[model samples]
Target: MDIITSHPRIVKMKKNDITLYISTFPLETEDDFLEKLKETFDVEEACDGKNMAECFAIIYGGIVISKNSIFKRIELEGYFKESDKGIEFEINRFLENPYNCYTFDNGTICFIKNKEKDSRFVDNVGLRFIIK
Candidate 1:
């Protein structure tokens, strides 16, 4: 995977003491992207708040974990996999799914995925933010 260092968010976030990074993993096809996405969700199924600080949000294919913030734990109650529609179906519609906001407090984790993964961006995986 190639590193996308020139993304605007990366530049802007840097000044704010937040780090952003994206991987250039080719998104060959939407199907492939969904599969990988499902895997990612599964791997991060729960944010038990083992060692959180303030609050965290999963935005646009990146994770923004903020320390000394105002959150304690994020409830994973309505995550895609928890939908009644089924994980596969929900995963397919994730791009436009409305239950996108997942917040946790005291040092939780968030995952970001963005439009950059579209063919317009050469189907490269979206930016993945990991702020300390």
Candidate 2:
């Protein structure tokens, strides 16, 4: 299936709904991915994919947030709830994991979970590229 059409946001969006610009695409490499990210977000700065953590920094809600390889999941009493500009969804499936991309502090980029069930990063290209 086409990545954009099969994307959760695309599949779930309604005609008159307010939503955030969340989408996923095939990831190629840190450099290439950063290049693509620049197209949407005003990326202030990024770390060298080899040090501290393979992280990307962007301004969201007027705050700079960075995502790195460190991942921790909290148990939920029910399906995980996430909302964006009134758009919401219950997370219960592998595909419903919401965020898909993860980068290690060592410069490695991969899925945060269910790597097998998800797509693959082939020849420097990753399986998922997420924008939130």
Candidate 3:
């Protein structure tokens, strides 16, 4: 899939010194796969504390696709302890879905379909996000 570097209204969030990137899944600009994301994730902008949170509906082609939310924060000693647990819990809860899965590489989040055999339709998907 192609990487989208920037967009007009993407949202960025920072917690415990770790940055979170969030953005809308463009339905028309890319290909049909993104359209699927738009249909499933219903990504939109919103606010969470001083940070920005993207509200999304997880859907797959007219079907309500199951999903989970993931948040990652820097594991600082006292100042960020609670925040780290909350973020990790959220990520774990989202990953528990049978049809969806996610992984964090360093701090980058990757959401994927949990299927044994991969198809082109699934392989063609891309994730959208913004960094502060």
Which candidate should be chosen as best, given lDDT against the real structure?
Answer: 3
Distance from true position, residue 127, model 1, in Å?
11
lDDT of 3 by residue, 1-132 (tens): 433322222223333433334332333344443444444543331111222222221111111121234433221111100111122314335435413222333332333333233211221122444324
Q: Whole-model lDDT, candidate 3?
A: 0.28
Ten consecutive residues with minimal summed lDDT in candidate 3? 75-84
Candidate order by TM-score, highest to lowest?
3, 2, 1
Q: Cα RMSD for candidate 1?
A: 16.1
Candidate 2 C-alpha lDDT tens digits along 1-132: 222211111111212221112223332244543554455443333323422212211111111112233322222111112222232322233235534332222222223323344343221111234445
* Every model's TM-score: 0.17, 0.18, 0.19
Candidate 2, residue 119: the lDDT equals: 43
lDDT of each: 0.26, 0.26, 0.28
Off by over 4 Å in 1: 1-16, 27-43, 46-132
User: Model 2, which residues run further than 4 Å from truth?
Assistant: 1-14, 28-33, 36-132
Clashes of each: 17, 2, 5
